[model samples]
Target: MIEAISTETTKFRHATVGRTGTALLGIGIALLAAVMPLAAQSGDPRMLDKLGEAGERSWDGLLSGAAQITGAGGLLGFGVVLGWMFGREFVDGTITGLFGLPVSRAQIAAAKLIVYLAWAVLVSALIVGALIVGGLALGLGLPPTDTAGGLARQFALGVMTALVALPVAWVATVGRSVLIGVVGAIGLVIAAQVATIGGAGGWFTVAAPALWALSEGDDVSGLQLALLAPLLILVVGVTLHAWRTLQLNR
Candidate 1:
Protein backbone atom coordinates (compact mmCIF):
# COMPACT_ATOMS: atom_id res chain seq x y z
CA MET A 1 0.00 0.00 0.00
CA ILE A 2 2.73 2.42 0.93
CA GLU A 3 4.66 1.72 -2.25
CA ALA A 4 1.55 2.17 -4.37
CA ILE A 5 0.83 5.51 -2.70
CA SER A 6 4.39 6.67 -3.22
CA THR A 7 4.16 5.81 -6.90
CA GLU A 8 0.81 7.65 -7.21
CA THR A 9 2.22 10.73 -5.46
CA THR A 10 5.20 10.79 -7.81
CA LYS A 11 2.81 11.02 -10.75
CA PHE A 12 1.31 14.20 -9.30
CA ARG A 13 4.76 15.67 -8.79
CA HIS A 14 5.34 15.13 -12.48
CA ALA A 15 1.92 16.58 -13.25
CA THR A 16 2.67 19.69 -11.24
CA VAL A 17 6.00 20.15 -12.99
CA GLY A 18 4.51 19.53 -16.43
CA ARG A 19 1.72 22.00 -15.71
CA THR A 20 4.16 24.73 -14.76
CA GLY A 21 2.57 27.23 -17.10
CA THR A 22 -0.66 27.33 -15.13
CA ALA A 23 1.22 27.30 -11.83
CA LEU A 24 3.38 30.21 -12.97
CA LEU A 25 0.31 32.22 -13.91
CA GLY A 26 -1.15 31.81 -10.43
CA ILE A 27 2.18 32.82 -8.88
CA GLY A 28 2.54 35.84 -11.13
CA ILE A 29 -0.98 37.03 -10.35
CA ALA A 30 -0.45 36.74 -6.60
CA LEU A 31 2.92 38.53 -6.84
CA LEU A 32 1.56 41.46 -8.79
CA ALA A 33 -1.49 41.77 -6.55
CA ALA A 34 0.48 41.79 -3.29
CA VAL A 35 2.95 44.38 -4.64
CA MET A 36 0.46 46.79 -6.17
CA PRO A 37 -0.57 47.91 -2.68
CA LEU A 38 2.98 48.92 -1.82
CA ALA A 39 3.25 50.98 -4.98
CA ALA A 40 0.04 52.87 -4.22
CA GLN A 41 0.79 53.40 -0.56
CA SER A 42 4.43 54.34 -0.77
CA GLY A 43 5.55 56.64 2.09
CA ASP A 44 2.07 56.57 3.65
CA PRO A 45 1.59 55.53 7.27
CA ARG A 46 -1.53 53.78 6.02
CA MET A 47 0.58 51.25 4.17
CA LEU A 48 2.17 50.36 7.49
CA ASP A 49 -1.22 49.32 8.87
CA LYS A 50 -1.65 46.75 6.06
CA LEU A 51 -5.12 45.37 6.61
CA GLY A 52 -6.16 48.13 9.02
CA GLU A 53 -7.55 51.58 8.19
CA ALA A 54 -9.75 51.15 5.14
CA GLY A 55 -10.94 54.68 4.67
CA GLU A 56 -10.33 57.05 1.73
CA ARG A 57 -6.60 56.44 2.03
CA SER A 58 -7.24 52.73 1.82
CA TRP A 59 -5.49 50.69 -0.85
CA ASP A 60 -8.84 49.11 -1.59
CA GLY A 61 -8.12 48.58 -5.27
CA LEU A 62 -4.91 46.70 -4.63
CA LEU A 63 -6.45 44.68 -1.82
CA SER A 64 -9.42 43.74 -3.95
CA GLY A 65 -7.16 42.80 -6.81
CA ALA A 66 -5.06 40.61 -4.54
CA ALA A 67 -8.16 38.87 -3.26
CA GLN A 68 -9.38 38.28 -6.81
CA ILE A 69 -6.07 36.86 -8.00
CA THR A 70 -5.50 34.58 -5.04
CA GLY A 71 -9.09 33.54 -4.50
CA ALA A 72 -10.19 33.06 -8.10
CA GLY A 73 -6.93 32.10 -9.71
CA GLY A 74 -5.70 29.91 -6.91
CA LEU A 75 -8.97 28.01 -6.62
CA LEU A 76 -9.08 27.43 -10.35
CA GLY A 77 -5.55 26.07 -10.38
CA PHE A 78 -6.25 23.78 -7.44
CA GLY A 79 -9.32 22.30 -9.11
CA VAL A 80 -7.48 21.67 -12.38
CA VAL A 81 -4.56 19.97 -10.68
CA LEU A 82 -6.88 17.86 -8.57
CA GLY A 83 -8.86 16.87 -11.61
CA TRP A 84 -5.76 15.84 -13.47
CA MET A 85 -4.48 13.83 -10.54
CA PHE A 86 -7.74 11.97 -10.15
CA GLY A 87 -8.78 11.85 -13.77
CA ARG A 88 -5.69 10.75 -15.64
CA GLU A 89 -5.68 7.25 -14.20
CA PHE A 90 -9.22 6.65 -15.40
CA VAL A 91 -8.52 8.31 -18.72
CA ASP A 92 -5.53 6.09 -19.46
CA GLY A 93 -7.03 2.97 -17.85
CA THR A 94 -4.13 2.89 -15.36
CA ILE A 95 -6.66 2.46 -12.57
CA THR A 96 -6.87 -1.21 -13.52
CA GLY A 97 -3.13 -1.51 -13.05
CA LEU A 98 -3.48 -0.34 -9.48
CA PHE A 99 -6.35 -2.76 -8.88
CA GLY A 100 -4.10 -5.60 -10.03
CA LEU A 101 -1.70 -4.83 -7.20
CA PRO A 102 -1.87 -6.33 -3.74
CA VAL A 103 -3.18 -3.07 -2.30
CA SER A 104 -6.88 -2.51 -1.66
CA ARG A 105 -8.75 -0.03 -3.81
CA ALA A 106 -9.66 1.99 -0.71
CA GLN A 107 -5.97 2.48 -0.06
CA ILE A 108 -5.51 3.62 -3.63
CA ALA A 109 -8.24 6.24 -3.28
CA ALA A 110 -6.83 7.45 0.03
CA ALA A 111 -3.39 7.68 -1.52
CA LYS A 112 -4.72 9.77 -4.38
CA LEU A 113 -6.43 12.06 -1.89
CA ILE A 114 -3.18 12.50 -0.01
CA VAL A 115 -1.36 13.22 -3.25
CA TYR A 116 -3.97 15.82 -4.22
CA LEU A 117 -3.66 17.49 -0.81
CA ALA A 118 0.14 17.59 -0.94
CA TRP A 119 -0.16 19.29 -4.28
CA ALA A 120 -2.55 21.84 -2.81
CA VAL A 121 -0.13 22.72 -0.02
CA LEU A 122 2.82 22.99 -2.41
CA VAL A 123 0.91 25.20 -4.84
CA SER A 124 -0.30 27.35 -1.97
CA ALA A 125 3.27 27.82 -0.76
CA LEU A 126 4.29 28.93 -4.21
CA ILE A 127 1.52 31.51 -4.26
CA VAL A 128 2.47 32.75 -0.79
CA GLY A 129 6.10 32.90 -1.82
CA ALA A 130 5.12 35.05 -4.75
CA LEU A 131 3.27 37.32 -2.34
CA ILE A 132 6.30 37.64 -0.07
CA VAL A 133 8.68 38.40 -2.95
CA GLY A 134 6.28 40.92 -4.42
CA GLY A 135 5.80 42.64 -1.07
CA LEU A 136 9.55 42.83 -0.51
CA ALA A 137 10.10 44.24 -3.99
CA LEU A 138 7.54 46.97 -3.32
CA GLY A 139 9.19 47.79 0.05
CA LEU A 140 6.18 46.58 2.00
CA GLY A 141 8.35 44.81 4.59
CA LEU A 142 8.90 41.07 5.11
CA PRO A 143 6.37 39.16 7.24
CA PRO A 144 3.50 40.76 9.14
CA THR A 145 4.28 42.72 12.32
CA ASP A 146 2.79 39.90 14.39
CA THR A 147 6.10 38.17 13.64
CA ALA A 148 6.82 34.54 14.49
CA GLY A 149 3.71 33.48 16.38
CA GLY A 150 1.25 35.39 14.23
CA LEU A 151 2.86 34.27 11.01
CA ALA A 152 2.74 30.72 12.28
CA ARG A 153 -0.93 31.07 13.12
CA GLN A 154 -1.71 32.53 9.73
CA PHE A 155 0.26 29.77 8.03
CA ALA A 156 -1.69 27.21 10.02
CA LEU A 157 -4.95 28.81 9.01
CA GLY A 158 -3.85 28.82 5.39
CA VAL A 159 -2.99 25.10 5.50
CA MET A 160 -6.25 24.33 7.22
CA THR A 161 -8.03 26.14 4.45
CA ALA A 162 -6.15 24.17 1.82
CA LEU A 163 -6.74 20.83 3.50
CA VAL A 164 -10.42 21.45 4.05
CA ALA A 165 -10.59 22.13 0.34
CA LEU A 166 -9.92 18.45 -0.41
CA PRO A 167 -13.61 17.77 -0.90
CA VAL A 168 -12.85 18.94 -4.39
CA ALA A 169 -11.00 15.65 -4.71
CA TRP A 170 -14.32 13.90 -4.44
CA VAL A 171 -15.63 16.18 -7.10
CA ALA A 172 -12.69 15.49 -9.34
CA THR A 173 -12.91 11.75 -8.91
CA VAL A 174 -16.64 11.68 -9.46
CA GLY A 175 -16.70 14.27 -12.20
CA ARG A 176 -13.61 12.82 -13.89
CA SER A 177 -12.85 16.20 -15.40
CA VAL A 178 -10.91 19.15 -14.08
CA LEU A 179 -13.17 21.64 -15.81
CA ILE A 180 -16.25 20.46 -13.96
CA GLY A 181 -14.44 20.42 -10.64
CA VAL A 182 -13.17 23.95 -11.20
CA VAL A 183 -16.67 25.20 -11.98
CA GLY A 184 -18.17 23.32 -9.05
CA ALA A 185 -15.59 24.68 -6.62
CA ILE A 186 -16.13 28.24 -7.86
CA GLY A 187 -19.88 27.89 -7.56
CA LEU A 188 -19.55 26.56 -4.03
CA VAL A 189 -17.36 29.55 -3.13
CA ILE A 190 -19.90 31.99 -4.52
CA ALA A 191 -22.71 30.25 -2.70
CA ALA A 192 -20.79 30.27 0.56
CA GLN A 193 -20.15 33.99 0.23
CA VAL A 194 -23.83 34.65 -0.31
CA ALA A 195 -24.79 32.50 2.67
CA THR A 196 -22.29 34.29 4.91
CA ILE A 197 -23.53 37.73 3.87
CA GLY A 198 -27.13 36.67 4.39
CA GLY A 199 -26.31 35.72 8.00
CA ALA A 200 -26.97 32.06 7.40
CA GLY A 201 -25.10 30.30 10.13
CA GLY A 202 -24.22 26.61 10.68
CA TRP A 203 -22.29 24.51 8.17
CA PHE A 204 -22.46 27.18 5.52
CA THR A 205 -19.45 28.95 6.99
CA VAL A 206 -17.34 25.85 6.43
CA ALA A 207 -18.30 25.89 2.80
CA ALA A 208 -15.81 28.62 2.01
CA PRO A 209 -12.98 28.45 4.56
CA ALA A 210 -10.33 29.72 2.16
CA LEU A 211 -12.32 32.78 1.17
CA TRP A 212 -12.98 33.63 4.80
CA ALA A 213 -9.37 32.99 5.80
CA LEU A 214 -8.08 35.28 3.09
CA SER A 215 -10.73 37.96 3.60
CA GLU A 216 -10.20 38.18 7.36
CA GLY A 217 -6.51 38.96 6.78
CA ASP A 218 -4.68 38.53 10.11
CA ASP A 219 -7.77 38.01 12.21
CA VAL A 220 -7.08 34.40 13.09
CA SER A 221 -9.11 33.35 16.12
CA GLY A 222 -10.76 30.40 17.80
CA LEU A 223 -14.08 31.56 16.43
CA GLN A 224 -12.87 31.05 12.90
CA LEU A 225 -11.82 27.52 13.83
CA ALA A 226 -15.20 26.83 15.33
CA LEU A 227 -16.76 27.90 12.07
CA LEU A 228 -14.28 25.92 9.98
CA ALA A 229 -14.61 22.62 11.83
CA PRO A 230 -17.72 21.46 10.04
CA LEU A 231 -16.09 22.01 6.67
CA LEU A 232 -13.22 19.78 7.71
CA ILE A 233 -15.72 17.16 8.75
CA LEU A 234 -17.32 17.39 5.35
CA VAL A 235 -13.98 16.77 3.70
CA VAL A 236 -13.42 13.68 5.83
CA GLY A 237 -16.87 12.38 5.08
CA VAL A 238 -16.46 12.96 1.37
CA THR A 239 -13.10 11.25 1.39
CA LEU A 240 -14.68 8.21 2.98
CA HIS A 241 -17.31 8.19 0.29
CA ALA A 242 -14.60 8.29 -2.36
CA TRP A 243 -12.77 5.44 -0.66
CA ARG A 244 -15.95 3.46 -0.51
CA THR A 245 -16.49 4.00 -4.18
CA LEU A 246 -13.13 2.51 -4.95
CA GLN A 247 -13.66 -0.44 -2.67
CA LEU A 248 -17.01 -1.37 -4.16
CA ASN A 249 -15.44 -1.56 -7.59
CA ARG A 250 -13.15 -4.32 -6.38
Candidate 2:
Protein backbone atom coordinates (compact mmCIF):
# COMPACT_ATOMS: atom_id res chain seq x y z
CA MET A 1 0.00 0.00 0.00
CA ILE A 2 2.76 2.39 0.89
CA GLU A 3 4.58 1.67 -2.32
CA ALA A 4 1.50 2.13 -4.37
CA ILE A 5 0.74 5.38 -2.68
CA SER A 6 4.25 6.63 -3.21
CA THR A 7 4.18 5.71 -6.87
CA GLU A 8 0.87 7.47 -7.46
CA THR A 9 2.05 10.54 -5.62
CA THR A 10 5.16 10.65 -7.76
CA LYS A 11 3.09 10.39 -10.87
CA PHE A 12 1.05 13.41 -9.85
CA ARG A 13 4.21 15.40 -9.39
CA HIS A 14 5.56 14.70 -12.88
CA ALA A 15 2.60 13.67 -14.98
CA THR A 16 0.55 15.93 -17.24
CA VAL A 17 -2.79 14.64 -16.10
CA GLY A 18 -5.05 17.69 -16.26
CA ARG A 19 -2.99 19.81 -13.89
CA THR A 20 -3.28 22.77 -16.26
CA GLY A 21 -6.98 22.22 -16.52
CA THR A 22 -7.22 22.03 -12.73
CA ALA A 23 -5.22 25.23 -12.34
CA LEU A 24 -7.44 27.02 -14.84
CA LEU A 25 -10.48 25.70 -12.98
CA GLY A 26 -9.23 27.08 -9.68
CA ILE A 27 -8.48 30.43 -11.27
CA GLY A 28 -11.87 30.55 -12.95
CA ILE A 29 -13.72 29.85 -9.74
CA ALA A 30 -11.67 32.37 -7.80
CA LEU A 31 -12.07 35.05 -10.42
CA LEU A 32 -15.82 34.47 -10.71
CA ALA A 33 -16.26 34.62 -6.96
CA ALA A 34 -14.28 37.81 -6.88
CA VAL A 35 -16.08 39.60 -9.72
CA MET A 36 -19.59 38.26 -9.34
CA PRO A 37 -20.28 40.45 -6.32
CA LEU A 38 -18.97 43.51 -8.08
CA ALA A 39 -21.24 42.77 -11.00
CA ALA A 40 -24.18 42.32 -8.69
CA GLN A 41 -23.48 45.63 -6.99
CA SER A 42 -23.04 47.38 -10.35
CA GLY A 43 -24.05 50.69 -8.65
CA ASP A 44 -26.91 51.06 -11.08
CA PRO A 45 -30.21 50.15 -9.48
CA ARG A 46 -31.57 49.08 -12.82
CA MET A 47 -28.66 46.72 -13.38
CA LEU A 48 -28.98 45.26 -9.89
CA ASP A 49 -32.66 44.80 -10.48
CA LYS A 50 -31.97 43.10 -13.76
CA LEU A 51 -29.60 40.78 -11.95
CA GLY A 52 -32.47 40.01 -9.57
CA GLU A 53 -30.47 41.27 -6.65
CA ALA A 54 -32.04 44.67 -6.23
CA GLY A 55 -31.90 45.98 -2.67
CA GLU A 56 -29.85 43.02 -1.48
CA ARG A 57 -27.01 43.73 0.88
CA SER A 58 -23.52 43.61 -0.62
CA TRP A 59 -22.14 40.96 1.72
CA ASP A 60 -25.17 38.75 1.20
CA GLY A 61 -24.89 39.02 -2.52
CA LEU A 62 -21.21 38.25 -2.44
CA LEU A 63 -21.70 35.18 -0.26
CA SER A 64 -24.62 33.92 -2.31
CA GLY A 65 -22.82 34.27 -5.62
CA ALA A 66 -19.69 32.66 -4.25
CA ALA A 67 -21.66 29.70 -2.94
CA GLN A 68 -23.50 29.19 -6.21
CA ILE A 69 -20.28 29.26 -8.20
CA THR A 70 -18.57 26.91 -5.79
CA GLY A 71 -21.37 24.37 -5.91
CA ALA A 72 -21.34 24.19 -9.70
CA GLY A 73 -17.68 24.73 -10.55
CA GLY A 74 -16.36 22.51 -7.80
CA LEU A 75 -18.13 19.50 -9.28
CA LEU A 76 -16.64 19.90 -12.74
CA GLY A 77 -13.21 20.80 -11.39
CA PHE A 78 -13.05 17.76 -9.14
CA GLY A 79 -14.31 15.63 -11.99
CA VAL A 80 -11.39 16.72 -14.16
CA VAL A 81 -8.96 15.70 -11.46
CA LEU A 82 -10.64 12.36 -10.70
CA GLY A 83 -11.05 11.44 -14.31
CA TRP A 84 -7.37 11.98 -14.98
CA MET A 85 -6.28 10.25 -11.80
CA PHE A 86 -7.87 6.95 -12.80
CA GLY A 87 -7.62 7.09 -16.56
CA ARG A 88 -4.32 8.84 -17.17
CA GLU A 89 -2.39 5.60 -17.09
CA PHE A 90 -4.20 4.38 -20.14
CA VAL A 91 -4.17 7.74 -21.86
CA ASP A 92 -0.42 7.92 -21.50
CA GLY A 93 0.06 4.31 -22.55
CA THR A 94 1.54 3.55 -19.12
CA ILE A 95 -1.14 1.27 -17.71
CA THR A 96 0.70 -1.74 -19.03
CA GLY A 97 3.63 -0.79 -16.83
CA LEU A 98 1.40 -0.81 -13.76
CA PHE A 99 0.48 -4.41 -14.47
CA GLY A 100 3.99 -5.53 -13.62
CA LEU A 101 4.41 -3.57 -10.42
CA PRO A 102 5.01 -5.53 -7.25
CA VAL A 103 2.05 -3.83 -5.64
CA SER A 104 -1.36 -5.24 -6.43
CA ARG A 105 -3.59 -3.44 -8.90
CA ALA A 106 -6.23 -3.09 -6.21
CA GLN A 107 -3.71 -1.40 -3.96
CA ILE A 108 -2.74 0.96 -6.76
CA ALA A 109 -6.35 1.89 -7.39
CA ALA A 110 -6.99 2.24 -3.66
CA ALA A 111 -3.96 4.46 -3.32
CA LYS A 112 -5.29 6.70 -6.06
CA LEU A 113 -8.57 6.95 -4.18
CA ILE A 114 -6.91 7.63 -0.85
CA VAL A 115 -4.82 10.35 -2.42
CA TYR A 116 -7.94 11.81 -3.98
CA LEU A 117 -9.75 11.87 -0.61
CA ALA A 118 -6.93 13.86 0.92
CA TRP A 119 -6.72 16.14 -2.08
CA ALA A 120 -10.46 16.70 -2.01
CA VAL A 121 -10.37 17.83 1.60
CA LEU A 122 -7.50 20.19 0.93
CA VAL A 123 -9.13 21.57 -2.19
CA SER A 124 -12.41 22.10 -0.36
CA ALA A 125 -10.69 24.12 2.35
CA LEU A 126 -8.80 26.15 -0.24
CA ILE A 127 -12.03 26.99 -2.05
CA VAL A 128 -13.55 28.45 1.12
CA GLY A 129 -10.34 30.21 2.03
CA ALA A 130 -10.13 31.78 -1.40
CA LEU A 131 -13.68 33.05 -1.10
CA ILE A 132 -12.99 34.58 2.30
CA VAL A 133 -9.93 36.36 0.97
CA GLY A 134 -11.89 37.49 -2.06
CA GLY A 135 -14.68 38.82 0.13
CA LEU A 136 -12.27 40.74 2.30
CA ALA A 137 -10.41 42.15 -0.67
CA LEU A 138 -13.65 43.51 -2.01
CA GLY A 139 -14.17 45.24 1.35
CA LEU A 140 -17.44 43.42 1.81
CA GLY A 141 -17.08 44.11 5.55
CA LEU A 142 -17.22 41.58 8.33
CA PRO A 143 -19.54 38.78 7.33
CA PRO A 144 -22.81 38.50 9.15
CA THR A 145 -22.99 36.07 12.07
CA ASP A 146 -25.40 33.90 10.11
CA THR A 147 -22.77 33.69 7.40
CA ALA A 148 -20.77 31.16 9.40
CA GLY A 149 -23.30 28.40 8.86
CA GLY A 150 -23.55 29.20 5.20
CA LEU A 151 -19.78 29.13 4.82
CA ALA A 152 -19.61 25.81 6.61
CA ARG A 153 -22.21 24.45 4.25
CA GLN A 154 -20.22 25.74 1.30
CA PHE A 155 -17.13 23.96 2.54
CA ALA A 156 -19.11 20.75 2.98
CA LEU A 157 -20.53 21.29 -0.46
CA GLY A 158 -17.04 21.33 -1.93
CA VAL A 159 -16.14 17.99 -0.42
CA MET A 160 -19.49 16.48 -1.27
CA THR A 161 -19.11 17.69 -4.82
CA ALA A 162 -15.77 15.90 -5.03
CA LEU A 163 -17.28 12.70 -3.66
CA VAL A 164 -19.99 12.97 -6.24
CA ALA A 165 -17.23 12.99 -8.86
CA LEU A 166 -15.88 9.63 -7.69
CA PRO A 167 -17.98 7.69 -10.13
CA VAL A 168 -16.09 9.47 -12.87
CA ALA A 169 -13.06 7.45 -11.86
CA TRP A 170 -15.04 4.27 -12.21
CA VAL A 171 -16.30 5.38 -15.57
CA ALA A 172 -12.79 6.23 -16.68
CA THR A 173 -11.42 2.90 -15.58
CA VAL A 174 -14.24 0.92 -17.12
CA GLY A 175 -14.19 2.82 -20.37
CA ARG A 176 -10.39 3.10 -20.46
CA SER A 177 -10.39 6.68 -21.62
CA VAL A 178 -10.15 9.96 -19.79
CA LEU A 179 -12.53 11.56 -22.29
CA ILE A 180 -15.15 9.00 -21.46
CA GLY A 181 -14.82 9.76 -17.75
CA VAL A 182 -15.07 13.49 -18.38
CA VAL A 183 -18.16 12.95 -20.50
CA GLY A 184 -19.58 10.96 -17.63
CA ALA A 185 -18.87 13.88 -15.32
CA ILE A 186 -20.72 16.26 -17.63
CA GLY A 187 -23.56 13.77 -17.75
CA LEU A 188 -23.80 13.74 -13.99
CA VAL A 189 -24.00 17.52 -13.90
CA ILE A 190 -26.78 17.52 -16.46
CA ALA A 191 -28.58 14.79 -14.58
CA ALA A 192 -28.33 16.76 -11.37
CA GLN A 193 -29.78 19.83 -13.05
CA VAL A 194 -32.66 17.84 -14.44
CA ALA A 195 -33.25 16.08 -11.15
CA THR A 196 -33.25 19.34 -9.24
CA ILE A 197 -35.68 20.85 -11.70
CA GLY A 198 -37.94 17.84 -11.28
CA GLY A 199 -38.01 18.35 -7.50
CA ALA A 200 -36.29 15.04 -6.71
CA GLY A 201 -33.00 16.78 -5.94
CA GLY A 202 -33.23 15.80 -2.31
CA TRP A 203 -33.45 12.10 -3.08
CA PHE A 204 -30.85 12.11 -5.83
CA THR A 205 -27.39 11.83 -4.31
CA VAL A 206 -25.65 13.96 -6.91
CA ALA A 207 -28.17 16.78 -6.53
CA ALA A 208 -28.73 16.61 -2.79
CA PRO A 209 -25.49 18.07 -1.47
CA ALA A 210 -25.52 21.10 -3.76
CA LEU A 211 -29.19 21.69 -2.95
CA TRP A 212 -28.53 21.34 0.77
CA ALA A 213 -25.67 23.79 0.53
CA LEU A 214 -27.63 26.26 -1.55
CA SER A 215 -30.63 25.97 0.77
CA GLU A 216 -28.46 26.23 3.86
CA GLY A 217 -29.69 22.91 5.28
CA ASP A 218 -33.36 23.77 4.92
CA ASP A 219 -34.29 21.48 2.04
CA VAL A 220 -32.43 18.17 1.89
CA SER A 221 -33.09 15.69 4.68
CA GLY A 222 -30.38 13.91 6.67
CA LEU A 223 -31.43 10.65 5.06
CA GLN A 224 -30.39 11.93 1.66
CA LEU A 225 -26.89 12.80 2.81
CA ALA A 226 -26.48 9.45 4.50
CA LEU A 227 -27.50 7.66 1.34
CA LEU A 228 -24.28 8.89 -0.27
CA ALA A 229 -22.29 6.42 1.81
CA PRO A 230 -23.57 3.24 0.16
CA LEU A 231 -23.31 4.72 -3.30
CA LEU A 232 -19.70 5.73 -2.71
CA ILE A 233 -18.80 2.37 -1.26
CA LEU A 234 -20.35 0.69 -4.27
CA VAL A 235 -18.38 2.90 -6.64
CA VAL A 236 -15.05 2.37 -4.92
CA GLY A 237 -15.67 -1.36 -4.59
CA VAL A 238 -16.43 -1.75 -8.27
CA THR A 239 -13.49 0.44 -9.22
CA LEU A 240 -11.13 -1.71 -7.23
CA HIS A 241 -12.65 -4.79 -8.82
CA ALA A 242 -12.09 -3.31 -12.24
CA TRP A 243 -8.42 -2.81 -11.50
CA ARG A 244 -7.97 -6.14 -9.71
CA THR A 245 -9.34 -8.12 -12.61
CA LEU A 246 -8.17 -5.80 -15.34
CA GLN A 247 -7.45 -7.24 -18.75
CA LEU A 248 -5.73 -5.72 -21.77
CA ASN A 249 -8.39 -6.64 -24.28
CA ARG A 250 -11.08 -4.64 -22.59
Instruction: Give residue 114's error in model 2 in angstroms.
Output: 0.9
lDDT of each: 0.56, 0.78
Highest-scoring model, lDDT? 2
Taking the tens digit of each residue's C-alpha lDDT, what string does model 1 give over 125-223? Answer: 665566556555655566555433433333443455456456667776676656666666676556656765665522454334444444554433456
* Model 1 lDDT-worst window of ten: 53-62
lDDT of 2 at 128: 69
Query: How do the residues 3-22 of candidate 2 rate in per-residue lDDT, one tens digit apiece?
Result: 88887778775766545644
TM-score of 1: 0.70
How many clashes in each candidate?
0, 0
> TM-scores across all candidates?
0.70, 0.90
| Segments of candidate 1 deviating more than 4 angstroms | 16-26, 38-68, 147-154, 201-203, 206-224, 247-250
Q: Model 1's lDDT to the true fold?
A: 0.56
Superposed Cα RMSD, model 2? 2.4
- Compared with the true structure, the alpha-carbon lDDT of candidate 2 equals 0.78
